[model samples]
Each structure stands twice: as structure tokens, then as C-alpha cells.
Target: MMGLPFFRTPEIETPAEIEAASLRSDRFRLQRQVDWQRLDSIVTALENGRPRRISDEDLLDLPVLYRKTASGLAVARETSLDAATLAYLEALVQRAWFQVYGPRMGFTGWLRRFVGGGWSAAVRAIWLDICIALAVMAAGTLVGWLLVSREPDWFYALVPGGMAGGRTPGAGAAALRESLGTKPGSDGLSIFAASLFSNNTGVAIMAFALGFAFGVPTLLLLLYNMALLGAMLWVFADAGLGWEFAAWLSVHGTTELGAIMLAGAAGLHVGRTMAFPGDRSILAAMQAAGVRAAQVMAGCTIMLIVAGVLEGYVRQLVGDAAARAAIGTGMLLFWLGYFILSRPPRERET
Candidate 1:
């Protein structure tokens, strides 16, 4: 009996005391109702399709009002307010909370920002890397073309088996010429484009994935890729189809090779960041580098997709070599304008 604890009954409020508590809650709400109404009006206007009517000052004050409303709600809960008043405050705070802390823009907004400037800005930031990638690819192509042209037999080593799907060294001049001609219909082009995309995507992804290996693999892959181009050029040149082949390749090469170069640049950016890291730790450098590289890589993927369509579909439908060259030149110029001239908004984007 000494060890056992006694339990006490809960305090029951008198009817008068309950009425007094409700009165106090009413008074509390009346004191705060003006500010709550102001917040409610703004929130309602925003929610009911009049967002533009809300002034900048109102927008700035919104969060402050939200906090005040929330505080009032807490007080209402603790003070035993009437059910109607508590529900009103609860709804006010709940709806206003979205305006205070919500996704300001959606997917379409993001797409607009990215297409307008974010991507080009990302590419421009890594101009040095792009230049280096371009230089390396150019050198590799030169080396491949020179070696194959001089030795002739070096074409086998420069281009792996079945890599040259169309104009290989073994192809006769007549066959090489025929490869550049347009088919009768647009039907085959889509399939060819799909195949081209699949093949190039593999190379692009491999180039990007290898960036973690300190960039040597990326460099080598780019070198090998350009070597194949150079070898192909030589094969066509040997067949007296150099102009036709250049036109054919250039039709898609403007965007296709450009995408590959951008991808290589992104990879090199990652590799260089990992290798050097400057004053920062490798992990910190990589974190920043990854974001920058990813931004560029996103644009690269898009370019590759466009290139695939041009190569597979448009080129197949267009018969004239002159027109193909013009199209190629136009695309190259378009990219130049897109990345270099299209300035980003001066205001910070979310």
C-alpha cells in the first residue's frame, strides 16, 4: 500500500469558465483580424488568377504575414477558440504557406531558361576546354588522313573493322559516289538516323563516363574518333569522291561532330578538375566541375539528337550535294550564333 501511487481525476472547467475562455479567444482574434484579412486578400488574389495585381511590396510582405498568421493559429489552438474561428485561421495559414514556400516556376519555365541562355552560358564558361578538344580532334584527323594517304595500307589500322559503314577503303569509286546520292524516299532516313544516334550516343556516353579516369581515356577516344573521320576522308578522296563525301559528312557533321566535341570538352573539364583541382580538394573541385560538365553535357545530348535527324532523315531526302553543303554551313553558323551571341539574362535565375 505504501509503494502504490494514487491517481487524481482530471480538472473539469465550469460552464462560465469555458465561456470566458472562448471570449478571450474571440478578443485575441479580433485584435489580429485586420492583418489576417490583408494576407487573405493577397493570397486569394494570387490563387484566383490575379497574381499580377499583387504589388512588389505586397510580395515582399507576404512571408512576414504568413509567419504572423501561423503564430495566430498556434495561439488559437492553445487558447480554446470556437471551432469556426480556428478553422478559418487554419485554412488561411495552409493556403498562404504555399505562396511563402513553393516552387516559383514549373517545367516550362525551366525549359525556357535553359534554351534561352543557361546552356550557351555553360558552354562559353568552358571555352578553353572546347578549344583544346577541337584542336586535338583536328590533329587526330590530320594524322589519320596523312598516314592513310601516304601508306594506303594504314587505313585498316586507322579505322577498325566495320567502322566505316558506308565508304570504306575497299569500296570502288563508283560505290563511294553512290553512297552520297539521295534515296527515292524519306522512309530509310529515319532508320538510318536512329542507327547513327545509337552509335554516336554510345561514343558520347563512353567519352563522358571515362572522364572520371583522369581524362586520358577521353583524350584517346576523341583521338580515335577523329582518326576514323580522317581515314574516311582519305578513302573518299582516293575514290575521287572527296567533294561528295565532304558534303555528305558536313550535312550532319556540323551538329554531330560539334556535339561530340562539346561532350569531349565536358569530359575534359571533369578530368582536368580531378587531376589538378587547383587550391581546392579534388572532391570539392569535382562537385563544382560535375555541375558545369553536366550543364554542357545536357546541351551536347540535344545537339546529337538534332544531328541524328539531319543525317538520317533530311540528308537522305535532299539530293543536291551543293544544298547539303549549304545546309551544313548554315547549321554551323547557327550554333556559333546560339552559343556566342545569345546573351543570358542579367538577372539571377532560380
Candidate 2:
């Protein structure tokens, strides 16, 4: 019983059967070979940066050819076509697909676009947040000035001892003036620049990162930092070094403070969007706002780097008060012009 199986074991394909399969595979390839070759040529031209070599008719035909070739790939996969034909079709379809729908520009082109107009547009988009943050910073500065003016103890409370660097409220005009002077050598300039850059970048990042809490933290952070500035301004102005102090501060402060303001504004933009999503859901609004805020923050980072260089090197090298003021004014003007005038033509139309 066990010896008598109901069905015979299936035999392997004969030589004739193997030949037949090969002929079928050949026929399949021959049917689609023309379309595949055309797609490959078009893709190769694009990849080689020879768009001019491709005819207008071929450009128009690209999507169609890609679709047809893609369909052939599907059929080959479903029917278990020969391995070589399968590989060729898969590769051809991929190339044709890229030609039909892919990023039109490279990284350099993207960077150019961003520097040329994209960043400024994003900043302009968040103008409301900027106005609010500016007002808060101003108020903070005034508060700091008043608090220290009313009680000298507030100066010690507002400014850290290391930052004070012996330029306290009681410090004489001579000591404060010397504090503003450039150090004798370049020994610590690099370290000073790196430290300033690190500190400023940290503040900027915190202002942005804390925006998720409805932007209150961002406002407070800006307020506290500006208050420190106001306290120091009082200390210097008290010592009759107000003009010199302003010049010293402005050489880097213009760019550095502007970056901080932008960072705060970016955070406010996100928080405000999430707090009041208007017609959109909170998630969607935050997503949209996050994109623009990110652009502004990216620009802020660049500004901070520039500020660090000015603070560390240029401020040290240039000692004249008027020269420092001029440099600061020039930087402010450049940023103003960049943000207001750098929109792309298309953006201007909209």
C-alpha cells in the first residue's frame, strides 16, 4: 500500500522545455526593449547634465515613457521573468522615475536660495512676535535701570560677579574705563570669542526651545538678560563711561542682541501659533510655525557667530569710541537692509 502512491512524482523540465522558457523570456524583452532603451537614454541625458541634448518632444514624453516602463516592470515581476531582464527593468524604471520626479536643484542651489531671500522672508513673516519681544526687552532694561538706581544692592543681584570683573557700582571711573580697554596681548582673545559664542548660542537656543510653553518663559528670559544689560549700563553710566561703554557694547551688541531678539521672536511665534491655531489644528499650526521659526533661528545662529568675532577680535583691536560706534551702526544698517530688502521677486509679488 505504501509502495503504491496515487500520483507520480513530477519530472524536471526537459531540454526542450528549458529552451521554450528562454524563448519566452527573449520575446518579453524584445517587446519592451524599445521603450526601456528610450527611457534609459532620457534619464542618462539628465544625469549627465545635458538637458539641451534632449528634444522638447522627448521632455514631453518622459512621464509617459516612465509610466509605460514602470508597468512593464510590474508585469515582469508578476510573471516571474528571467533574472537579467528583471534587474534591467528595475534599474531602468528607477532612473526614469528620477528623471520624471526629483529635486531640480543641488545643495549649492538650495544654499544660494536661502541666503538670497529665504531667511529674510521667514523673519518678516514673524514680525508681530518681534515687536512684542522688543517691547518686553525694553521694559526689562528700564526695570533693571530703575531697580539699581533706587537701590545699589540690585546691581549685585542683577549682574554676576565674574561679569562684573571689578566693574562694580562702587568702582571708580578709572577702573571701569580700564575694564573697557583691550587687553595687552592676543593670548585670551580666541578663548574669549569661543566663550562668548558658546554663551550667546546657549541663550538663543534656550529662548527658542522654551517657546513651547506658550512663550512666557522666552519673554522672561529676554527680560532677565536685558535687565542685566541695563544694570551694567547703569554701572558704566554712573562712572561717567556711558558713551565709551555704549561704544564698547554696541560693537558686538548690535549683532548679538539682534540675534537674541530674533531667537525670542521665533519662540514667541511658535508659542503664539500653538496657543491660538486659528482655523487650523494645534499640531498643524505648530508645524507650519515651526518651519518659519526654524529659518529665523538658523539666521540668528549666523548673526551670533558674527557677533562673537566682533566682540572678541574687532572690539579688542579698535579702541576709539567713535570707530566702534560706526562699526556697530554699519552692522545694524546691513541687517536692516538685508531683512527688509532681500525678498525674492516672486515673494515681493505675493
Candidate 3:
């Protein structure tokens, strides 16, 4: 007992020690109080949408004040400042940092940029991939038509049972024609649209996602999808409803198929970069290609959504073949013009 004399634990802070800490914190705050307050005010004005209230001089001073406050926080952290001072500085530094270096634009601004030129720019950046994908798709369609023409059995292999939905190879003209028309009830149109959207989205995603496998899978996917289209076309053509089916499909197919091509191109772009990295490492090339491809894929998703709407509602409501063709043609032109004519801000300036 004598050997183990009572000793004060370092964990216990005495009242006088607490008071000294408080004084040190107060003195530290006083030294940097003005800069901290200035940063807080600027941040407050920005957060409250009162940027106009801030003066030009204060705006110019913002970064400097932010750096000073951040430095103060570091010092406080290192010196074991009072908890209250540390907490205040932490909050103030976080708010200041956001105002100083956070995102320059909101979602709406980003969307406007994307729609105006970002999407089109991304699409243009992968023009080579788009060309290759288009060729592959056309070849695939030809192959499907040739296979089904030679042997009706190939239709079952290309088109799924649910998709065929009574529009099989040997189906009568009346049945095939009826299949092209809208159903009697309108209640299920929403569900139908959603289902189509989900299905098309899945195909688009697969096409885009499979590019990581050196793009072979993506090419195959695109070919398979176009072959399905070819199979369907053959079915309708065999019954003399080819033009009718073409019109029906065009109402949505222009957009949907375009989206698929873009997705395929995105995948191919990734694959091509990986295969031929040039001076850069394969990983670096893939990263660069991925950014552009992702942008194109995003646009493809929007296109797929539009296609779903047109397929579900417009295709159903519009029975006239000419009108449907006109709509589809107009959409195709719109996309072409948008991608071709729409220039980025930098390009426009130049």
C-alpha cells in the first residue's frame, strides 16, 4: 500500500486546467475571429441564394479567408483546442470549403448543358464505333433474313416465344395485322410501356456493359438484337404486311434501334481502346474511353425511354401507316441534326 502511493490520473482535468484551456481557446478565436466571421457570412449568403448581397471585394477575399480558416482548424486540431472551439471551426471550415470549391452548377444546369451539347458531343466523339456498329447491325439483319427465309425454324431461334406473341412464321395476314394494332383497352398501355422500357433498357445496358470483354460480346449482342428485328420483319413480309409492320415498328423502332446502336458503339469504343491503347497503358485508355462512352450511353437511355413511350402510346394511337412513317422519319432527322449540327460551347466559340 505504501509503495503504491495515490497519484492523480492524467484523464482527470482539474477546474483550473479547464479554465486555462478555455482562455487559450478564447484567445485563439479572437486572433482569427474576423476571418472566420467573413467566411461564415459569405457561405451564408451563398447558401441562402443571396449572392448579390456579397460585395465584389468580399468575393475576391473568399478564398483567402477560407484558407485562413482552414489553417486555423488545423492548428486547433494539432494544439488540442477546447471542444467548443474545435466544433465551431469544423463546421465553419466545412461550410467555407463548399462555397470555395464545391460543384459550380446544380443538377438543372448540368441537365441543360447535357441536352444542349454534352450528349451530342459525346455521341460524335465515338463516330468510328458508331459506324462499325451500324455495319455489324445491317449485316446481322441480312443474316437473320437469309436464315429465316431459307428455313422458317430459325424464327423461333431468333425471336422469343413471348415476343413472337402469335405473330409466328405461319401466322395468317389477319392475325399479323391485328398484332400490329393497339389493343381494345387503354388501361394496360402504361404497363405495356413500362415492360417495353424495361426490356429495351436491359438490352441497351447489356450492349454497353459487355464492351469490357474486348467488345466481342457487344458485337454479338447487337447482331442478335438486329437479327431479332430481321426475323420479325420477315414474319410480317411473308404475310404482305411488311409495309404495315415497318410503319408500326418505325414509330418506335427508329429511336429504340438508334439507342441500341449507340449502346453498341459505346461498348465497341471501350473495347477498341483496350485493344489498341497506343502510347497509353490499357487501363488509362479504357478510363478515357469509358468517360466518353458513359456519356453516349446516358443519351442512349433517354432515347430508349422516348422509344418506349412512342412504342406504347403513339404506335397504338396512330393507325395510319403514313403518319407513323412521318413521325419516325422526323425523329430520325431530329437525332441526326442534333448530333451533327449541335456544337459544344468551345466549338461554337471557335
What's model 1's overall lDDT? 0.81
Candidate 1: give its CA RMSD in angstroms.
7.4
| lDDT of candidate 1 over 128-242, digit per residue (tens) | 8899889989988998999888887788776655555555666787766766677565232344334545666777888888888888899898888788778878898888878
Question: Per-residue CA lDDT of candidate 3, range 215-240, in tens?
Answer: 99999988887787788789889999
Two-way TM-score contest, 2 vs 3, winner: 3
Worst 10 residues of 1 by lDDT: 1-10
lDDT for model 3 comes to 0.83
Tell me which residue pairs clash in candidate 1.
Answer: none
- lDDT agreement with native, every candidate: 0.81, 0.84, 0.83
> How high is the lDDT of residue 265 in model 3?
94
The positional error of residue 85 in candidate 3, measured at the CA in angstroms, is 1.6
TM-score of each: 0.75, 0.85, 0.90
Q: Which order, best to worst by lDDT?
A: 2, 3, 1
Error of 2 at 259 (Å): 1.1
